[model samples]
Target chain A: DVKVTQSSRYLVKRTGEKVFLECVQDMDHENMFWYRQDPGLGLRLIYFSYDVKMKEKGDIPEGYSVSREKKERFSLILESASTNQTSMYLCASSFSGANQPQHFGDGTRLSIL
Target chain B: DQQVKQNSPSLSVQEGRISILNCDYTNSMFDYFLWYKKYPAEGPTFLISISSIKDKNEDGRFTVFLNKSAKHLSLHIVPSQPGDSAVYFCAAIRQGAQKLVFGQGTRLTINP
Candidate 1:
């Protein structure tokens, strides 16, 4: 089975602080994505990396950034944490194809104070 | 512009009864669609999928139907069990695209 691991299951941070969420995939997939789940908003993509050092902005990319320095690791960075940024963040990985389904991690519930 | 939409916010059904979840898309470029089931505090897992070329696909107790002309799809679960209760999200990917656009999702509850 494909396993996507998120570094944090839950996190709390104060406003204006920088927060990082890490994700690693064991399946060696070529695509990685970050998304935030909000009530009545579903899962909105923040950023996605199709290859190492390559990134693309998704629908909601403001207030966030991503890094994919290596093939297996992807990181999401919050420029400055805010209360509105508090959400369940999900990391997913998949192969380079239109038919492949992306495998997701358990998600990190971040609370900004 | 919410390209993908799940009109129903929630659905309730009795145990051993059939559960039908609906989804609609406004994008004509989308050629593939998928359904995912998510539990609280966990991630959404892939459930079933259907291609725009095919109208229906079935697996065990789950079935997916696609209506290309209407840009609509539905997931049918036969004899739903209590464990089947979860949030169902419908997602779509445009032709040759790797990114998927998701709907707001519908919460499913199975009552005994």
Candidate 2:
């Protein structure tokens, strides 16, 4: 079985604070993704990394950045947290293929005050 | 524009009955479609998938039907149990594309 782990299950931060969400995968997959899920909006992609040191912006990447210094770890950074950024963040990983199923970690519910 | 759409926001069904969830897409370029089930506070889990070339795919208790002409798809869960209660998301991907476009999702509740 593939395991994806998120560093935090829940987080709270004040406005204008920098926030970091960490994710690690044990399956050695080459693709990793960050998504934010909101009520009535479902899940929207924030960013994705295809390899170490490689990153690509997804649909909604504003106010967010990503780091992929290593293969097993991917981090999502919020330049300055805002109340609008509060959402359930999810991390997923999958093999390098067109239709490969992605394995996800338990989401981190973020609250920006 | 939202490429994938799940118009129904919620559905309720009695246990041991069939539950049908619907999804539609506007983009004809999408060649692959997937269904994911998510529990509260948990990320979406890959449930089943079907390719554009095929109209139907089935697994134990779960079946996915695709209609290319209508650009619509449906997921049927037979004998839905309490454990099957969750939010179901429909996602699509173009040929050779890595990114998946997801729908708004439909929440399904099963009554015991």
- Candidate 1 lDDT tens digits, A1-113: 99999999999999999999999999999999999999999999999999999999999999999999999999999999999999999999999976899999999999999
Candidate 1, residue B30: Cα displacement in angstroms equals 0.4
Question: Residue A98 CA error for candidate 1 (Å)?
Answer: 2.3
Chain A TM-score, cand. 2: 0.99
Q: What TM-score does chain B get in every candidate? A: 0.98, 0.99
The residue-level lDDT of candidate 2 at B112 comes to: 98
Q: Please list the C-alpha lDDT of all candidates, in the order they appear.
A: 0.96, 0.97
Query: Per-residue lDDT tens digits of candidate 2, residues A5-100?
Result: 999999999999999999999999999999999989988999999999999999999999999999999999999999999899999999998799
DockQ of 2: 0.87
Sort candidate 2 into its docking category. high
Evaluate fnat for each of the predicted models and list the values in order. 0.80, 0.83
Chain A TM-score of each candidate structure, as shown: 0.98, 0.99
CAPRI quality level assigned to candidate 1 from its DockQ score: high
> Candidate 2, after superposition: displacement of residue A32 in Å?
0.4
